[model samples]
Target: MSERSAGLLLEARGVGKSFPGVRALQDMHLELRRGEVLALVGENGAGKSTLMKLLSGIYTADEGEFLLDGKPLQVSGPRDALEQGISIIHQEFNLMPDLTVAQNIFIGREPRAGRVFLADRALEAKAAELLDRLHLPLRPGQRVGDLTVAKQQMVEIAKALSYDARILIMDEPTAALNDAEVRVLHDLIRRFRTPDTAVIYISHRMDELKAISDRITVIRDGRYVETLDTATTTMPEVISRMVGREIAGGAGPEGVRDDRPVVLSVDRLSTKDLLNEVSFELREGEILGFAGLMGAGRTEVARALVGADPVASGTVSLRGKPVRITSPAEAAKHRIGYLSEDRKQLGLLLEQDVNANIGLSSVKERFQSFGFVRAKAMRARSRELVDALRIRTPSVDQTAKFLSGGNQQKVVIAKWLVKDCDVLIFDEPTRGIDVGAKEEIYRLLNDLAAQGKSIIMISSELPEVLRMSHRIVVMSEGRVTGQLAAAEATQESVMHLATLRPETETVR
Candidate 1:
């Protein structure tokens, strides 16, 4: 073997995989060197997940092969893959919430006093040693469900490492984490890296790739694109390679006129939990952004406004008239719609087709006449929206779950549009979506604003907040700490407000 090949810990040689009517991966190849973090980046449907699954033995490759330490690698399943020194942590966690941390980590391999009896104390003791060795801030006795999302994620890492995995695969590890949490997670990864081990990290967050990855592999539409040194390649260059086009950076929405009519106003909006006296206004043809750290009540504010959560006190006004919205149904009646952050769980029916999901909210009001359902009308409207939104689908009959993350998001937006809602609340609109698709969503939002539809866009990404909002409201510990116009807002300024507490003086 050559000296360069000797350094490769894992190599995918002409790997290919396919499913019914979809070539998920084609001639895909990747190289991971000893003790380095290799970032795999691409659009949502670019087959990143498929490649990872094949590596972890969740799916077998239809063609080509994987070489581990310059030898053919073979595994029957995930368990077998772990036995072969490979571990994969998916974006959606696989932990059982009700189990204790120790129970979750050592699950099927719990220590036993004998072949007949399980040793509970021994199981926890083993987990404790692992946690202590890794320096993870988790108690073996702690219930997994009671831990925060960041803590829960640590459990997953601990579990993966427990198998003495030589190759670690992390999928979107920081997708749901805050800045502080991300720093902690990255520290753990750095500690885990050794000359005998390597990491394959998959994420769409460009900033994170710069911080964590040693090299980046770009793929597009199930095909290998290029690999570049993270230190030498600019983020925009990497993004261009991923999307096969130059992405022009642009400014946020221009200032909305002071004379613009106020479409929706919330005064002293308060909820029983996590939301204080929050106040904001949505002007016609404006994009009002909500920004904050995790658990700062940005989503809580949206829920309270749309009646998804109970409001202890506050007043809501629509078109300058006072209104009481006690439920989502009431909010819908007032032409208000909320597109939740957890689109798969809360927004769309995964089993249903695009046409059904798009027209679902308006079935009673628009797609029904004299107690009769109008399938033809729904299909036509859905097709029109599919075209308008540029949703990539073979047909409206395609299942919602089958579409990419970006297209699924667009379908949710179309649902709100079909309902004729003037006030739209979008929480984390582009979360888990690729950069190219994010650009499309940004343009779509601007188009909607131009059409005079007021929008409330809540995002955890500061860049997104700054790029899309006409005005931004910063929240900290469930309170509106400050509001900034697009021209005045910067990441540093927004972060300052996001960390400001109730005891601190506020910014207007």
Candidate 2:
């Protein structure tokens, strides 16, 4: 341990937890010293969330000792944790959209002038004070719904500060923030680092982790691996520890051929707020990448192309002719399918079985006859997909909600496959999945491309963009700033284009 036990602000010794068939955490140990940022890194489902719940009092440790300030910590609930000067900011903001910032911060513990009356002014005053202390440019009376995601996150931090929290836990804080917003958040975190405060940061972004963390603790498969000082440790070493192996990076555009004809073409595409005359061509069997920071219009392009969002003015050409796509169903008729980044909400029905989700897109054509459904055919076809994708499930009847994140993603892919879509748009395809599962998905994508599927992949992760893309289109401020053949694309060049503004030289 770099820090001494006597000065440790929080400590978890021999922590263990389990859910019904999953041992999420076992024999996990953590120590957080005063005035330090401790980064917690692991693959998805590696017990990072479980450990966080234990720390925040959402879940009790089945076996372990929690010590705070040199004493045994006894936290029975969230209230107890808060009272003990611990606060957790989840990935999703917990604030009610309709509520004002003041209302959200002091919701349950509101000040009252009398037993029967409320004190709105007092609440706003207190909230304003907290925000002001943090140097946040937000009004206490402002509705959380109206604020940008970055501003709303600031409100979450302000709420935590209201309790004079000594320990703070932030989970994927910059997942929704742009590059500029990320810098603002990093400044706030640095300001919050006091001799009396300890911070636990959980993130998957390697660059952010390296920039903000003092020490990194890696957890793999719910077990502690090792802790290293961020300044001294290399990224490869850290990744190796977290995933238990080196992640093999691919050579640019390997095995891609120029002879493949254009399968899809977008000409002068524009959306109301997001896209601005964006144009690109995807060749058959090509993986074209869209690289950008958040809100750079990467996802907007995907949505528009698939008819999930209306295009203000554009021409979409399949093969040699133009086609009008005004809805998702219409896009499907053109054989274009989209895999959303928020797969849980947009891609799959959690309550439905794998077979249902896989067969959903093609139900009319494959499983329906004379207004009647063919359950037996649906099951048979879905079973084939399950075997082909190597989706781990007891049977095709297993509910989507019960499957792991990776397997759920596979089911989403299966839906497109069943629809016989040759053009697929994958938005952040591997976003919350484990490393092993990521490799599987990569292989699956490669297989699809080899079979003549054209893919437009949108990703925020630069490394992922560089590794899998045959060609990359960099977007900035709703415009295509630059295009690069895979062999010439690097993190620096892609980011340079990604940060280029509308006022800058047009590179498209």
Candidate 3:
């Protein structure tokens, strides 16, 4: 135990927590060493976030103790943790949109002029210096909301550094980033691997876990399983650890190819991004997964298909029936559903009740005599959907904002389900879910496909692409580089296409 704990700067031993009937976490153990990037992984509800919360003072551990530098310590909250040289950068960054990057970073600790006026320019200068050190090309005077997702994340990192954070916790940092942006983050994480800092990196991408993590820690159902060195471990071994078994083959995940029909066909599709003369077809009753590296314009195609974004030009056919998708509403009228990658911003009505969100897309149908909505019917229908989709909520009346990321995602699916859409485009469907919920989602997708509902799944996870897809589409830059049947697709081949190629270069 001493050997395993050697050189550890922070450690949490035998951590446990529970919420009512759910044992959210139990016997959870973790350690952080100087100059190490530890990847913490588990299924949604496996208590990855819970454990992090405990470490960072978001939640007090119901049991066990946290030792900072081998001495027991107590973390009260974000402010306390920050003061203790620990910081967390969440997926939803906590920066003020109206504030400039510099102001946001050095917010409360502003360089004051005689304790009254803020030396705004001086603050910006300082922030700019930090951004430069981090290799983030962000102008300090820019507003947080105005920046791209990746840039905003960089800003958060810079802010963390301002606190002199020795330990940084990053949650799904690249979930919204393009490949180029991801590279920038990769470089930033590497920068933290200096002699004194420790980075706790959490992500669902196994490929990234190998590429970035020095050590990988597996937690399942709230228990610390094992930690393996990145050089000595395989992705399959890591996945097996996370999921607790070998996944027996079914139809393969949405991205893997199998014997299936093409349900929705896109012929000569063009978009503003990397989608150049894109053409493809999705088959009903098969989870057709779209596999691409970041910046592949897969999301752009999905956006275009649902008319969430404009298409430069294209013809979309539903079961060979050509249709014009002018907007999301029009696409919905054609029985097409699109789940946005930015669910919080575009896909959900946070203030509304779960039933309200589920019934949102089909509220008109709930109308009865005198054009009045049947509230009882809506609640009844939402109840059925809750059961069917396994949405975790106190009741149908609960706000969409109150649910966890996984349950919120399920609600989004329920909305489309109520709409009875034939073609469902799931963009990063399991983005923040733990292992258990992820498998449940996989099964749900399979059931949806089995019911002859055509699915266009867009995911960055290679295993999901390999396991769920019957056919795989590889995209790079803004164009389709290659398509491989399930039998032909491998991580190496997929990644080869995923790698960026210069436009001047010719495609074989």
* Winning model by TM-score: 1
Q: Backbone clashes in each candidate structure, one number apiece?
A: 0, 0, 27
For model 2, the local distance difference test gives 0.84
Better of 1 and 3 by TM-score: 1
TM-score against truth, every candidate = 0.90, 0.83, 0.78
Model 2 poorest 10 in a row by lDDT: 248-257
Write candidate 1's Cα lDDT for 258-306 as tens digits: 9999999889989888787888888999999999898788888988998
What would the per-residue lDDT of candidate 2 be over residues 1-508, giving only the tens digit for each residue? 3438778999999999976556878999998989999999887667787788788888888998899987899889888899888899876567888999999888898899999787999989988888877777789999998665557777887777677788989887776555666787788789888999989998877788889999999998789889999999988788889888788755645636778899999999998877899999999999999998766888889888888888899898999799888887888888899998767758999999898899977989889999999989999999998998777677898888766566788899889889888899998887655555677778888888989999999876788889899999999889999998888889999999998987787675
Off by over 4 Å in 3: 1-8, 11-36, 57-65, 70-76, 96-155, 161-163, 177-191, 194-196, 206-276, 317-322, 366-399, 481-484, 492-508
Please give the lDDT score at residue 283 for candidate 1. 98
Number of the top lDDT candidate: 1
Cα deviation of 401, candidate 1, in Å: 2.8
Please give the CA lDDT of all the candidate structures.
0.89, 0.84, 0.80
Lowest-lDDT window of 10 residues in candidate 1?
145-154
Worst 10 residues of 3 by lDDT: 499-508
Cα deviation in Å at residue 127, candidate 1? 6.8
Once fitted onto the true fold, the runs of candidate 2 whose alpha carbons sit more than 4 angstroms away are 1-4, 92-163, 254-258, 352-411, 503-505
